[model samples]
Target: MGTDVNRKAKHILIVGGGYVGLYTALRLQRRLSRELRDGSVRITLATPESYMTYQPFLPEAAAGNLSPRHVVAPLRRVLPKVRIINGKITKVNHAAKTATFQPADGPRRDIAYDIIVMAAGSISRTLPIPGLTDIGIGFRTVGEAIGLRNRVLHQLDVAESVDDPDLRRRALTFVVVGAGFAGVEALAELEDMSRDSIRYYRNLSPRDLRWVLVEATDRVLPEVGPEMGRWTLEQLRERGIDVRLNTRLESCVGGKVVLSDGDVFEADTLVWTAGVRANPIIESSDLPIDERGRIKTTTWLTVAGVRDAFAAGDIAGVPDATNPGRFCAPNAQHAVRQAKVLADNIVRTLRGEELVGYRHRYVGSVAGLGLHKGVANVYGIKLRGFPAWFMHRTYHLSRMPTFNRKVRVVVDWTLALLFKRETISLGEIHHPRDEFRAAVATGRKH
Candidate 1:
């Protein structure tokens, strides 16, 4: 949608820049370039950022195993023909077939579109738990991953410098709330990295480090089945990880985690990765949403009751045909598969071809347990330890989208096999403005 245009090839406006949005855009970009009848198909992707952060690599980014910069794709670079606007869609008027947007640095604007794809993704689902707003670190973004790394490294410094045992203990203890992929893998990878890092620091040993995982549910990685969940728990327990299942973080006033199980632990780090809810922006849009606040979509990925509107990913509650009883789970695998289907459906609608329904079975789940240990259950086959870990890397690498990116990621892994993991922390970048302000204030005083 733009200032003036005879709608050519039926303009496609994709909202959101996360998994579903990016994948859909990528596929559409290639398809449009190669297959479109007359370049009549105009694609525009509008989102808050001109980049897409690969969420799956956040754990590796947190552990400093992968550079955070390597986990993002610049939208403009990947899809040159596609108009990439840095903005957020504030309203969607399906009746008029238009969306209102607020740009990064301009007046508000309206976009009239022929077709709309709402992939506005999910946000970190947070509760009003005491002190969570200020203390809990989210596990959804690359920035948070880099921040967590700095905090972990600095915590090691705190442990080394402090003479008080209690202070050292508090600094060394890292608490992660949530046993999902983000929390579990982050805890595992960081713990593994930190344990390896102790050789450089004479004051701390692997035994001195405390890694705690607290989950409200009775098990971790529930998608991997009860057996796998139980097995994963045992593995964590065997590594001295204090996994508190059927427990909740009641309060964390002043870095002390008070659990529902009537136990208390003090730690400087609190990571929140319990789950994600639809992005709050959807609530403001003129569309029907489910009880959980997700856009309801049919088997064909069209907005359940709205014509010309389609959505996919975490924000869209897409009905699962294979299961027939539930919505598609908001995981990377589903999101990737749904994007392809959603893109094809959009193109189909433009070409006057019949839109096909989205149908795919759950292809099992995988978890990387750090330092070359892993767990996975794919197509009814279960794997654990090194085998599972190898599969985990392989699956994610293969599914990493572009062939160019795939090669770069594989190169990173190959280099990692030969060289030691980089433990350098870039904490300074987080507070560049603060340092400038302080320097200016001090200069005035002088």
Candidate 2:
């Protein structure tokens, strides 16, 4: 039975609400509204959240410069014409042309659509490091950002207490592993925030804080060249950050971190921004995937050997044509650009036109180190310090999707210029449980 073209519009279901999914839907609404209105196409975007978080700003969110909510865009507002179904896809029955999803509120619902776009983005890649789930916090989502902010400030609070040097050292020490964009930005931002916050707590000083960054690789930000990584290392070390290259984190017990470099460091806070893996949604689906579990897609964003199905972003192993037997590197720039190509390809497929593949050579790489500092390499040029920082903000703000959001972010920056940054900590949110328990105990005793 072919798709019923006489009924409601031909359904195009997009899974995952991250950069690729949301942008593709937005482009569809902007370009294909006529098709949707004339009963030619019906578009629906099914994602776990109603927003797409611009991940580049997440480290700044952890640092408290950008509001976590501001980092994400509400899908309904951007693509109001498209149906926004909030759910996490568990199974994709491509043969049946249907996908099973567990909604945010309701029971699992099986949705049938004529076409599907698997843009399910990546998840925080974590290893089975002992005591990680219980003692460590991830740096992926807005929730994790908030949690890290709370945890960092809470560590300060713990350090401000009574006279046990051992305990104080543990409270003040913060261990961060991985030197990629996420790790470097996070370490720099959090360290800057915590250092500034010490003024509010008289007992905690900048010297008391021991921030360590461990990277198994020889240097940080492999996306950038080694020269830039060395420059970043210089900048970080200048700010008193201990950047350990060619070092591995052997294990992290209750709070103490053991490095393969034979250094045993004790700390109360351990943040893992190591890396990310493709979304597990692929494994559940009856789709062909590469060894890395990414759906093998052709140059035009079409899944190999699959009909009317497409994928992009971190989840799809797009063949990097230039590098034989290799896939396109996963990053935000590709995800954003790939969305346009993917949307165009889908439209072309609908109209029986020829499709083009997605190919974007990395234009540049940039990283923000707390306030007023950064590094970048664009179009064969490398920059550092204030200029790179300015470029970073300008590029991201321009590419931040909506004008409304861009204005808000720019305004935030302006206000920051006029007023000193706010370093007040909101660390008590995590200790409410302990307070409640203590209150209950006191009442029972009385």
lDDT of 2 by residue, 1-446 (tens): 12223336789999998989988998888788899888789988888888888988888888878877788888888888998988788889899888887877767767888889999999888887776776788787887887888888887877887689999999888888889988988898899889888888887778888899999989888877889988899888988988899998888877668888999978878888898898999988988998788898888898899998999999998987667777888888889989999999989888899998777777879888878889999987999989998988998998897888888888778887887767656766656688889999999999
Q: Which pairs of residues have clashing backbones in candidate 2?
A: 125-276, 299-357
Model 2's lDDT to the true fold?
0.86
Q: Which candidate wins on lDDT?
A: 1
Q: For each candidate in the order shown, give its overall lDDT on alpha carbons.
A: 0.86, 0.86
Best by TM-score: 1
How close is every model to the real structure, measured as TM-score? 0.96, 0.94
What lDDT is obtained when candidate 1 is compared to the true structure? 0.86
The window of 10 residues in a row where model 1 has the poorest summed lDDT is: 1-10
- Model 2 stretches with alpha carbons more than 4 Å out: 1-7, 428-446
Model 2 TM-score?
0.94
Q: Kindly list the per-residue Cα lDDT of model 1 for residues 1-446, writing each as its tens digit.
A: 34434565577889998888899988888777754447677888999987888877778877766777777888888877788889899888878777888897778878888889999998989888998887789988888988998888888888999899999999999999999888899899888888878778887788999999999988998878888888999999999999999999999989988999999879999999999999887787788899778998899999988888899999999989998779899998989899999999887886789999989999899999887898898999999999999888888877775677777777778888899988765688898899889999999999
RMSD of 1: 1.9
